[model samples]
Target: MKSNLVCRNRETVRINEYIHMPKQLSPAQVEQFWNDGFLFPVDAFDGVQAKKYRNLLEEAERDHPGEIHAEHRNNAHYILKFLDEIAHHPVILDVMEDLLGPDVLLTGTVLFIKEPQTPAFVSWHQDSTYTGIEPKEGITVWVALSEASSESGCMQMIPESHHQGILEHHDRFGENNILTRGQTIEGIEKERAVDVTLKPGQISLHHVRTVHSSTPNRSDDRRIGLALQSFIAASVKQTLGEDYALSVRGQDPFQHFLRARRPQSDYEPEGIAFREAANQRLSDILYHGSELKRDY
Candidate 1:
């Protein structure tokens, strides 16, 4: 499993030979991700560590009234350094690198939080549909900050649906659907879906074309999950618009994206401006040529 990767300025280096790569995801789990279109319960952080992140998010929500709402949550990693740290966490990078090779780029991250007995829920859809990344060269790592169970609205995926490629999706704009456009697919058998349950500090990885959604939270506690999108740097290109990606591991010789910088502080004026501009561009790409522009 040794290979040479090219970095910026046409430089080449051996990934495994020079770097201390951790074996996070076992071969069985990797195979499951490919075969079942998703793998869950990958231990990422401990319960104590998870609580620290949850506290930060709660503090942010309390500090800024509506700033953490649906429209602003899409790219929260770029706006806050703490979120960015989690996205670039060593454990997460190791798993992503194992699947996407050494050259990995973080495209975007969105925080989906469901309140107790709330109507908020995600509709069934594929991430590749609106992502605009061709050839389905991406994986989404969903990290749970709190316990995620069927009762708390954990994500559910249809096994082997990713092999069918991208399916037809129609925008319904459901009132309580958490998805940006309320996009959904038809003819899906709900009974075939598997709940991707995870304890606090665990995560689930799914392919870009996987058909997935979440139910409304029925428990009293809040359900917090961060959806991180990772792509191989070599596969990145200016498909819909300028691709804004942060290289988390190895090097990106392709230069296909606008390299994002680390934030100095959470919600700084300059960082907020940059995050807003980048998010606007992404929304235009994901919601382009469509009448329905649901806030992400």
Candidate 2:
């Protein structure tokens, strides 16, 4: 558990071998996240590994055709081993712990895949608008399974928007919008937004309150990304009723949300059923009191 580092530019600063120091987020990067609301292109996985991960999604689609639809894309980690592994990945978790502190919970995971020349788009809206998690202490790590270029509809966000707190959003449910309600924030200056472009295996971490959206894919290939939602376990409250959460690190003493069991195999019957039930619970929290059937 102990390691030593040798500095080339100066005398080596010997960090205590027993002390745990996180190298994921530099102080500047942490500040940038708080001030700008997001960070992009963090190296999380190698290209070869990323391709393998992407293959898992393709394989799932082949095995369970028509099941990865937007409404049903939530909680994929519960039924897929590849996704579950990424959900608990150390690199992602360490950065999350750096920002959210210990006691991290992998709350949800979903695929946002846009086929080539499709009308799919994500409306500009803050994730908190639907998450309903109180204290608002969480982040969404969008991991690119393929190149997330501007032409491929990479996510775009307004800087420092998180500091404004949750903004008002209205349900549009547009034909091409992938959001549950087609929710969007009004009057955003397109010129002020920054594209969160990423190559395969990289990631963009955005705060829950960050105003973000994506355009329709215009490329010749599919644009695939995984949104991994995590939060400080102790910060989760009962405001949205009992829910399911996976403890990826540290201890969960409060048990604010129901603990999820890892799947024994990909899409195991029991795991799928459990994920379905849990997704329904989540939908209730996100779209509470609405007549719309629980989806997403």
Off by over 4 Å in 1: 1-22
Q: How far is candidate 2 from the true structure (C-alpha RMSD, Å)?
A: 7.1
Q: Candidate 2, residues 80-144: lDDT per residue as tens digits?
A: 88888988888998888766667788788888999998989998999877777876657899999
Worst 10 residues of 1 by lDDT: 1-10
Evaluate residue 190 in candidate 2 and report its C-alpha lDDT on the 0 to 100 scale: 82
Residue pairs in candidate 1 whose N, alpha carbon or C atoms collide under 3 angstroms: none
Full-model lDDT, candidate 1: 0.81
Tens digit of per-residue lDDT, candidate 1, span 1-296:
00111121112113432354336876667666666778888889999999999999999888985668656788888778889989988998888876667788888888889999998999999998887775565789999999899999999999988777678898888899888888999889999999999988998998887899999999999999999975554556657878688888988888788888678988888888888887888899889778978666
